[model samples]
Target chain A: MSKTLISARGLRKSYGKRNSKFEALRGVTLNIHEGESVAIIGKSGSGKSTLMHLLALLDKPTRGEITLNGHPTARLRAHKLNTIRNKKFGFVFQSFFMNANDTVLNNVILPLKIAGVGYRERHRRAVSALKTVDLDDKRNNKASDLSGGQKQRVCIARAIVNDPKVIFADEPTGNLDSATGEKIINLLFKLNREKGITLIIVTHDQDLANKCERQINIKDGRIVSDTSADAEQDDDGDEEIREIIAESEEDDDEDATPDKFEGDNNIDGMLDQKHPVHHINIDEDEEDL
Target chain B: MKFLDIIRDANANLLRNKLRSFLTILAIFIGSFSIISTSAIQAGVNNFIDQQVDSYGGEGYLAVVSKDSFDALEGLTGAMGNGNSTPIEYKEDKIQDGMTPITNEQLDKIKKIDGIDGDSLVEQKSLNISYVSSKKTDKKYLIGAEALPPGNIKVETTTSGQLDLQGDEYQIQLEKKYVDVLGYTEENIIGEKIQLVVVDQFKHTQKTFNVKVVGVIAPGVISMGYSYVNNKTADDIYTENTKYYPAEYKDHVVAIAVNYDYKNHSAKEIKDKLEDIGLSAMTIDDIIGSIKTFFDVILTVFKIFGFIALLAAAIGIINTLFMSVQERTREIGLDKALGMSSARVFLSFSIEAISLGFWGSVFGITVSMILGNIANNIFHAEGGFLESFPSFNLATYTIKDIIIVTVLIMFISFLAGTLPARRAASKNPIDALRYE
Candidate 1:
């Protein structure tokens, strides 16, 4: 097996106070090897996003430890974490959160700029990253003026500008149609294959998950099935597990309608519990079927 | 992130909301304009006053009088207006009516003072002139004239020549207004003789003495419209005016002008030594200190108003930045997620505030300078208040004051920015990213 780049043990995350506490992740322990394309699949509120956040070190777990490159990350200072994230990881979100008023080149320069790269060198790297995504010609154009696909391509350029060891993508193509989504997926996979950059994607799309080399399915904060573990079994067993994942997704969709109202209230309560003044709440309800 | 990148992004973000940023800058501009303008005016006034001080016998010059005489003069002026002191009790030993003369004993002691230049002492005598007349005009005008004080004194003049204090010939530095009335231009008046008629009050007789015009004196507050004459002219005129009086009365000296070592000894030290001999001394500052105090009070009030305006501007900075922080929540999240440190996030916002201050103060200094020059020109034009005083500028700009104001305003802006910057820096990345 390839060397493990990241490993987690008994990861748990909970939101709010003791009485109204919601455990997003109960106990998720996993290991991701170098250069692997992995997809974490789950419906809304299944804690797939929370698990991804912990593994990416974007957040700390309530009762767990995460190790990156065999070194414990729990005791690291905020400055070290920021430096690690800046130099080693890149992220892509569904909304392509870019400075809309800025040019595409500046948008792609964000990561390199954060890493404090020299002006000319960062510019050259950003341009080269843009070339990788085949959007070099549109670099000077305003980010807001671009189409959704082009904007996502620019976001991808930003992600790879620092030459990160791992790229964490959260619903990278959720806002794009299938044709545009396929192109984005291909680009991400191409980076994974050619540059040997690890890809960790969090999504509810089964087709997108199936395309990845490994798939981890989460349900109610627990790992239900992992395709890598099933790979040791027969081919028929792998097919059966895939069928089970699809049926469970269908069951979640059926169960979602009634739980939608309660889930929204829970989000509101969670927002109040976390930051009453900011009103920063996750829109988990919108991600459901 | 690099500091330069933070600054660049800060300026870019400000441009994203031009109108809002402009209004905040406008508020700061008002404060800076008022402050810098007042400072310029204060500097101009100080420059003019310093020039006047130089025209008067300069740093070491002192006017010595008997303590009783100085107190009486003060009492008279105090009664006339500005009643700041209580009425003095009538003391038998103090002179109640007129000025007390500096006795020969006091004069001898004054000459003995450590820093006093004994040879520079000249008895102050009022010249009783009947009238001044030039041959070209055939018209005589009443005039007040006094001898130029001892030591190296340069009277500010419209024309070139200086009075020869020790000249054997009667030399006079005529006032500017007298030059035109005497039918001579400032240039043509040089080396020409003018008649100074001194009249005897008892005998009712007049003696006309011809004094050469050396220079035309510039109009100034300290000169008080008095023409300057050499010692020969003043002594002859005084002798003629008091021809019928007793010898003792002729020698009675009310005041004396003297110079001291100002660099080695302060004016107060000399004054204290003179006071020990029952005499009072007034330095140039004591003579003109009231005018300075008046200007200082007015300028201080104006500065206070400027600070109030700056306080309001600081609030405006806080308000503008808070709104900006709220608007750029998602962008800040993306920056933080991209690994921009919390301190850098705070710095970016602080830089935005500083940029606002920079632009505001720069605009303020530029516009105020333009307007100050325009005002100076207007005040110095014909029929304007400052037209008569050509040496006085109504506004002055110094590089030190400009730099100080810019740094001060920028610091206030940074302080005002801290509130919003801290809010931006402390924002949790996940929550901010999820904030739709």
Candidate 2:
């Protein structure tokens, strides 16, 4: 719909070295346009997440060229890159990634705080962002007190608080129940449609990827296929995606995708164990009783 | 980030672990408290010594006496006394054995000495002084009034507000007890006439004269019985009284005030020169110098203890800050990911350390000042708990000293925080984010 917001060419990321060198992303080239909704989809360790990270500017690629809004970022200094990350991008993670001890409002205000906004202005903007996510009444509550879906909503609010040019959600709804996950996907689509914010998601959920206008399937550290649907008629092309999903499900039993969790046995695992239930279900059960 | 925002962030981070932050501040507190308290006490003692030295004939005047009389005056002034009636057994040693007093020839030799401005004869005649109220019969107040050379005596206002002495006034600084016998307050005693009767026991003849009281001084070592008189007037009175004395007693002078500009000549040089001329000289500075050395030694010992406590506190700061960095790993990563530069991260931690030092020093100084004032109040009350000791403040810290101590504490804290801050700054955001 618009000029390229972020473009990456010949991106590569490898772990270990020499004989043990294992590449997570190899020669990935993609361009994401402004206000576009794109999903990088693959099973675990298929280099989809690594490709997203490369586009997000969270890590330096071993070899690549990334142009952000037509500015070459290959040689930008770390501090300059951090400024770009703060002012131009926002990120959401699978585990909600909220600071459990801080208030809901502080969680959303963090990006603005890093941007060095004054306290009163930060408070006002954070409150407005929370209201956008319908969490304004819970502004003073610690993140630990929020339910899983609410925590994800808070993460979205934080991601949009700086009003960045792009939002990166890596498995944003992976931990939520199906109904809640559907709501979160709808929220991401609504932001893309209403606010004209670019949305890039890394996920394996076929149902979620079929909703986007563009879907790139990564397999064995390479792009196996790129598919696009008419923006107003993405549902008309979902039948084809459903067939593809059925074929992948048959292959799931024999799935041998490399375990991304093998070396990633720290953050994601720790976050998952930190708050599994969110206790909202138990509270609802008590209310039912 | 702006510098103020960085400080604000650091403040919030420190609050995350309240107990650790408070403990670190307390360590700095202990160190600053000891240093401030010791400095206050040292300042108090130094102020007292300065006042006492000022009260004793301070500068530019030398006490010229015989080697024996020099020793006697040193004993009279050095010993702790109220300076009323403690005579220096002047009749026993040299005078009874027929040794000649300081003669006019000796005075001329001193006046001719290089660097000598002018000299005056000190009237050492034993005079029985009495306040001339109507009733005065058998109470004889023996006082020694010295007539100092020109420009040697400077009268300063005492607590009772005595008037400044004018030219050629016949005045006496009466003893505290003696003034009380006359039923006159120190302020009212000015311009009152006092009778002085010089008695020559060998000749059995007494000469009497009346002198007007001018300035009143609290009796101390320098002036026994608050005794100071105008040089010319006392010289005239002495000459009048000695008109009938025999030849042996006519040339008898106990001491002389040698008026050398001592700024060019050190006290040691003057004392040595006088000794060459068969005389001895002493300055108030020489005596006070030794006393100052004693106080300085005590203060040095106190400072050593304070420094040791400070060293221990510095170690405590290092320990606390290092632990804080370790615990705040994830938080630090979050800040970096939020676009905080490594330099800002480092500065934030450093500012936190400095703030810890600031609060510690501020609290320590405030509490110590309160305690010091309380102690001083106790020591200054009527018949104070410390009445047996000399009347002086026990602790007094100046604003300059307080500022210096606070800055010193902050600097040490900043230094102690450097290593920990560097560690936090150099932490890889990826690894720190991965840290649980």
Candidate 3:
């Protein structure tokens, strides 16, 4: 019943000169509706990332027609395209591309900063996002100090902090262990269900593919199969993911030494509220406190 | 992105690469340092020369000499062309004929010319003076007295116009160092009378007179230590010394000069009138202007060397910014992907370049000013190398020139940054993100 948010027709992308030219995507067509959890599953060199890039407006296809909210975006100027990208779309890459020198809160708040949001409001929202991911206690830690799973969590927080209409995650838990991977999946699914945001995930993991409501299989730059799951939701899967998150939370508490918990108690007090009251300013020095 | 946010991001990025940023700034520092130092030295030298010239010459004055003294051979040739058949008996008086002064008739004639407001006669008579109250009686000082045309003589006076030499009070001016020879303090020697023995060159006899000292003047590079006699006293001595000379040679004035208001008359017109009457006039401005022109050429040459250094520094900035663009390809791509416009990205890098110029010039000016003070102490020290030179400064700092150099360097840095900023702005976001 959801309206279509983005639709692409006859998308084509090629690389290099005529004699040495290689095609990445060939006449691929697809439609993604709002509030739908969709996954594009493909092997290596199958152009799932290329399709994601075009849909996100991060690139221009060699030959294609793309429409967003009923407006054709193929001829839109760069600034307008960037505006759409900044306001409506959020991306989480497989590599967890975070500024190593910046604090966890700063990494989460960068999009708002770029969007020219006020200092106090962005700080509040960044803290709320971090708390949702259960990393509010580590908001002041440098991004480099975080473990791989924790890094991925920060990336997710950054992706959702702006409340975008759609979230594009490419192999969201590819680098984590099974327990950490399950925790990431639970966070992503919680955001999708709670916010009603359209979620598009590209992954080779079949277990991750089964959780989505719809799946598109791409091979050799073509869609081989497009299938949709039944209306019956996976209650058992949700319960199992919740159990994994609970065990990880217990482990996180055991490892939280006195030094790590210094300012964390104050953070927990702020996050305990449905909405934080004190408007903290988001700056480099404010993170340490 | 907002302009302020872009600037802040640029600052943070530069701070992350502190060593590279500092090294780039050092190159600009060297360039600006040379420019500031050279400009200071030039200003100092020119300022000193201007002060020296002002003190050396009274403003708006002209100098004139007797036509015979100015054109000695021409007058003699004209006098011989009168066609007297008898071969003139050439004796001492005949040998001194060409050295005659401007006659009273000539002075009266000049007074009637247009724009000739007033005239004065400079008496040229050699006299020997001895401080009468001094312990050293054997030392006699040779002095010359004259009513010199305003610009001809350069004398530095400690107390100007203290004595009216034309008044009947028979007074004289003594040199400042006469205190040492007279064996008395400066205050004590003011009212003292000194004996002068006038030795006439033509008459070959000495006549003695005593004149009271009224004021003191200092000795300088141009004017050595010579005492002054009042105008009335000078006339009396001149009449007595030449009393036995031939009647025809008796009434000649030493020199005849005229004064005209500078505001009313042009120098060219005055010079033209004087030349018509077979006389020449020299103005102080003409002499000073010619001297300054010589120094200006030397200053221009020094400035060229500073400009060359700045040009090299500009090239260094361009190269450094290009390298930074290459190194931060992925970062730029991320920024673009995050919703930064191409203009904002260009502006961010441009601001970073300007900041480099700002720091370099600020440091250059500060360090140069400190060094200028140190050099001032060494070169302008008492009895130092520059001591013999009057009113000389080793370095002089001016605010206007420093601001100009800073602006020029910043402009060059901005121009150099444009190439790399454009390259960054025009980059394809997908390609940049894939830079790896």
lDDT values for all models: 0.84, 0.71, 0.70
Interface RMSD against the true structure, candidate 3: 7.3
Model 1 TM: 0.89
**Can you list the residue pairs that collide in candidate 1?**
none
Model 3: per-residue Cα lDDT over B109-196, one tens digit each: 5667666565543434543332233333557555655432343233445654355645776667777766557665567767777666
What digit string (tens of lDDT, one per residue) describes model 3 on residues A1-289? 5688898877788878999998887667777888877778666666888888889898889987799988999889987988888888888877677888989999898888888898899999999999989999999999999999999999889888888999998877666776787778767877887898888998766566556667766655655455642222223223345335434543433211112211221222422333212212122221010
Quality of model 3 by C-alpha lDDT: 0.70
**Quick one: ranking by TM-score, best first?**
1, 2, 3
Q: Could you give candidate 1's per-residue lDDT for residues B18-112 as a string of tens digits?
A: 99999999999999999999999999998899898777656788988898888777877887768875555676644446578888888888788
What's the true lDDT of residue B421 in model 3? 86
Query: What are the per-residue Cα lDDT tens digits for candidate 2 across B213-250?
Result: 77566534335345666654566666766667787667
- Against the native complex, each candidate's DockQ, computed on alpha carbons, is 0.41, 0.23, 0.26
Residue A187, model 2: lDDT of 84
> What TM-score does each of the candidates earn?
0.89, 0.77, 0.70
lDDT of 1 by residue, A1-289 (tens): 7888998877789999999999997777788888888888777889988888888787899987899999999999888988888889989888999898889999999888888899999999999999999999999999999999999999999989999999999988788887788789888988988898999998877666655777777777766666664222212223455456546675545322222222121212322332112211234536321
Which of 2 and 3 is the better model by DockQ?
3
- The C-alpha RMSD of each candidate to the native structure, in angstroms, is 8.0, 9.2, 12.6
TM-score of chain A of each: 0.82, 0.79, 0.78
Residue range with the least summed lDDT across 10 consecutive positions in model 3 chain A: A280-289
